[model samples]
Target chain A: MNIYQYDKSKEWFQRAVKVIPCGVYGHFSPAPYAPVEAYPFFSDKAEGARFWDVDGNEFIDYMCAYGPMVLGYHHPEVEAAFQKQISISDANTVASPRMVELAEFLCEMIPVADWAFFARNGADVTNMAVMVARAATGRDKIIAIKGGYHGTSPWMQAPGHHGTIADDHDHLFRIPWNDLEALDRILAEHGSQIAAFMASPFHHPIFEDNALPADGYWQQVVDKMHENGSVVIVDDVRAGFRLHMGGSNEHYGFKPDMIAFSKAIANGHALSALVGTDDLKVDAAKVFHTGSFWYCAGSFAAALACLNILKAEDGPARMRMLGEKLTGGLRDLASSHGYTMIVSGEPALPYLRLADDETLMLQQAWCGECTRRGAFFTSHHNWFLSTAHTEDDIEKTLQIADEAFKAVKKQFGS
Target chain B: MIDQLKSRLNLKAVLRNLEVLPALDPVSAELISDWNISLRFSVWRDTQVVLDFHDGRCVFHSDSKESTSVNLFFSSPAHLNNMFENQASPLPLKGFTKLGFLKKEFSQLIGRLEYFLKPAAETVQDEAFKKVNLALSLNTAVFAIPELMKLDPVSRRIAPQFSAGSLQFSVDPDGPHAHIIFDGQSRAVAFPGPAVNPTAMTVFKNSEVAQALVAGTLDSFAAVATADIQLRGMIPLIDHSNVILDRLPLYLQ
Candidate 1:
């Protein structure tokens, strides 16, 4: 067995703790990721579907840098376009033509989107979307799913966190997922006060397995939002480009008034897009949203290139096909080991958990073993399949998973 | 209004709610462990009570006159109402209330208590934060400060050096009232034991600034440089306490 050493990573985490506060912050922090003892606290470098930790160990990455590298990191076309844009200029005093070009491409790609806005991250776009909703509707209340994650702004950080002030989330409503009755109950009371009902394109929680919209659930919510005069904001930052070129809205059979996208937008570039219809165009323009890095034209060029290549190659379909094969292979292997692996969400965005392991210890043990054996997978967070992942890669991953399951069974007595 | 006030001001329940911060918010708890106090809060003819801090837990009393550590005098319903609502902020406490005095004793309670504030659609925005506070007890610091501190990130770092340190505070309007004991064994903060000999002690101009300092919402370093808090011992400890006691707001997913 080739076990990756964490001497360097351990040393780095200790150093990081001294200055970085909890060693590191946010989702990327190693503490929140399970099997923490085995996970690397820092990444040295990454290119195309794989990343090397600070310790120099390599693995076939399925985390995809936590839902960013869609076109298989550092794709030549994307990189070439970005390089060309950078050679001319990135951020300038005046608005770059690339911004308009990217916006035009987005409005064209996403059928329902008539206008687009640029931001540096998903949180910025979502926050801006809320501001735009409030500005447009003249309402203060916004509703989101109970456990689904939006980003970490003051309003969206979970309720009981020590530092959250009373006013921070006073107007935000968290309702149960897939429950129409609960949705109706909240809307009945605060319907007129609500500016928007925001949620992910799908139900993907961090600890729990992902779930698709119950049949008619999405349509009903859309109808209700329309009936109540509340805007629907599909947070497609994670499920965007992966589902369809137009985003999850295209596949889900409904369109949202506002869609915020980032994560995989530019094939791992730090760029986010807020696309909406003409109705919200004036309000979107009225909202104050700007980022120093958001104006960097290089990211815009990369985004355009990534979009072109993905559409031409039909990247979503290929990713789905590869992901489906990987899911079936992993399930068979797990079943062979007398463990049932439940891969939730679509194949492109699979969330793995055990059918029988309620506490997730067994799942953690399996993922720990898999990563140790050279498959960079997350136990709790969802996994992303990309075009960079090949059929051979899937085969190799299945082999590694089989061995990992064996280790899991031996350790956990399953 | 008095009968209505009794139902709205539940100070005892508020203190009990905050007793859990040491286990949950490690940084705020550790900073709190350095102090011990038995301050008395009196609301005219209504309720007079004593609160004892023991091992990260608060012992609440109702209408018992057992020689409290300090005495808070509320002249009228309006005074108690004002104190209960605004909390730590300067109120019209007669002429020259010297709030910096009360703040020095019970300041940390503000920030540490916020970690326990649950989600609600309409939280007490202008004060009476612990909605329960609007119902029963007259003791105000426990509920009011936590509500105010929610805007700032509570400290997440746990410091071991505060374990042996102790600070006693005496605010005017209440004399020799509260004490802070940080005699824990490890980085985890606990209530200080009796017979604590302290390294440093301090008084504030009023409770307004003192609560802010202990909460780590207001920088203790900058507070000292500005002489916002009067000190009695180990200038360096008071100067550098917040370094080990604070972080940006945490939203762990």
Candidate 2:
């Protein structure tokens, strides 16, 4: 096999370094996980589960553009709808009727969604959710899970984080994720001041394996928050429409007063829907929320199309099967190679954890080899699967995984 | 720019400074006593520090990793000093009193950082503004944004969330107008040059509004609405001004 080359990518990166700060910083920085010389630095185009880099190398994408390509890259149905909408008018001062159609569809599909508001990203939805909850309860403080990613509002970010100040995080109260006792203590101490409790449907931080709520955890937390008159906000950013036709709250057999949706809602189209119960609708309406391009009709059109396909294809069930297959296969492969792997989170949004490797050195080497062999996934972050990944794609990925594992054995001798 | 996280995070220096570190002012400590503030500073190229502030104490972590709760990210030393020095000046000191959260001792924190950065300049002067801009801009002016991904996956994701053109905060009431421009990508350039033909510019009528905003006194929305402020270009850009202006106090190491 030809060794990976990054000549084109390196040139592009040098240009990017001049203008872009930290040169591909954040989750997009590939130098941390994959070797700088081996990783393809820039992608040229994408379709289905495949994307071509600037160097003309193609790979089966598991990053899924960091959790947006649910139906796949440039999905025909979604793009067709988007193109049709753009041919007409894309954005208007007065929002299009497409919003009404999308909102109505959400209400019909999601059990907790009595009415919905639209935004451009998960951060906007979660930020608005916090405001709506605070407005409804007239409380200053909010309770959230520690290490949860709720979006990029000042309130959600850590103190001293660039672009934000003290007031941003002053109202937040963080408790350990899935810790019932910690939740009780926090509630007992500051329940009245708490306006809302926000969290994703499952645990999916980049550093560790994603975990779900413990048994009966959501129910107890909900009951306690409701008793204290605080609102419940479920952040369905990564798990939106991926776990169930309804909200992930429904799948978990619990409910939230407000839910934030993004990622796969429009099959990679940038859009976020904040749905909430009827009781919170009045307060939600009063918030001063508007964005210049938030009312893009093309994204709504794509969402409408994507929702239809999800229902018709029963996308969640299919995704669950796919996840199970991938998870089982990877686990088996790891065991055969004298390694252990733990798969966490929901069926569709799973996290891979290698057992007993403290520093993730082995994990990094293995994933780097797989990436060189033209497979796209990350050792540090969780991998996302889309409906676009066929059984053959998974089989091929497993074969690549087998060889990659062998390479890891050669390098580290584990 | 939150979703565009790909690989490089220069949060090391800020973390180190916060951890093994600076003597924080009492007011700053009190404000964050109930909150945990994580800061990442990229000092040199690829070198970063991760800092977590809890209960008025700061802890330096082993790695310059990402945190969802990071409220401030400083790309370099100059950026951080600019924020602190701007906040320290007494001219904008009046505006801090107007803010509800900032009213309580936050000025002391700003002043403390200002003192730490400039340290009285060996002689005291009545003209506070002269001292701050001189001290802040003395060592370095602006560092070029390390360009890596402009159209890549993560870069592509965040760029669309903002407007296509540049956004600037025109903060000078004096000559040689200073403005910070967000190039609609990862870079936010602070220019001492003329604020010529800006795509969108938020002009501070005076230094008070500038200090207030930088001191974290003025609620981002209120700063634009204030009588001392004048906005040009798109109105939406003014609304999103916090995307650039709020990052001033951050010294990205």
Best by DockQ: 1
Error of 1 at A61 (Å): 0.7
Q: Per-residue lDDT for A1-414 in model 1, tens only?
A: 687777787777667666765566667755334455556767878878788888888888998888889988779999999999999999888888999999999998898799999988999999999999999999999999976778988788754354576578789988878889988998999889989999998899876778899988888999999899999999999999899999798898988899999988999888999999899999999988787888989999999999899899999999899899999999988888888889899899899887756646677767877887778887768899999998998998898888888787777766
Q: How good is the docking of model 2, as DockQ?
A: 0.02
Give the runs in model 1 whose Cα sits over 4 Å from its true position: B1-253
Task: Compose the digit string of candidate 2's lDDT tens values, residues B124-181.
Answer: 5345644343323311222112211232232222333344444445555652244445
What lDDT score goes with residue A65 in model 2? 87
For model 2, give the RMSD to the true fold. Answer: 18.1
lDDT against the true structure, each candidate = 0.69, 0.67
TM-score of 1: 0.65
Per-candidate DockQ versus the true complex?
Answer: 0.03, 0.02
Error (Å) of candidate 1 at residue B225 is 36
Residue-level lDDT tens digits of model 2 in A1-414: 444666787677767766776456655764344333446768879999888888888898988888889888988889999999989989787889999999999999899989999999999999999889989999998888766888766777644445666566668877878998887888888877989899998878765678888888899889989999999899998888888889888888999899999988998888999999999989998999989989999999999999899889989998888889988998899889989988888768788766736445567667777787888767767788889998999898898889988987887676
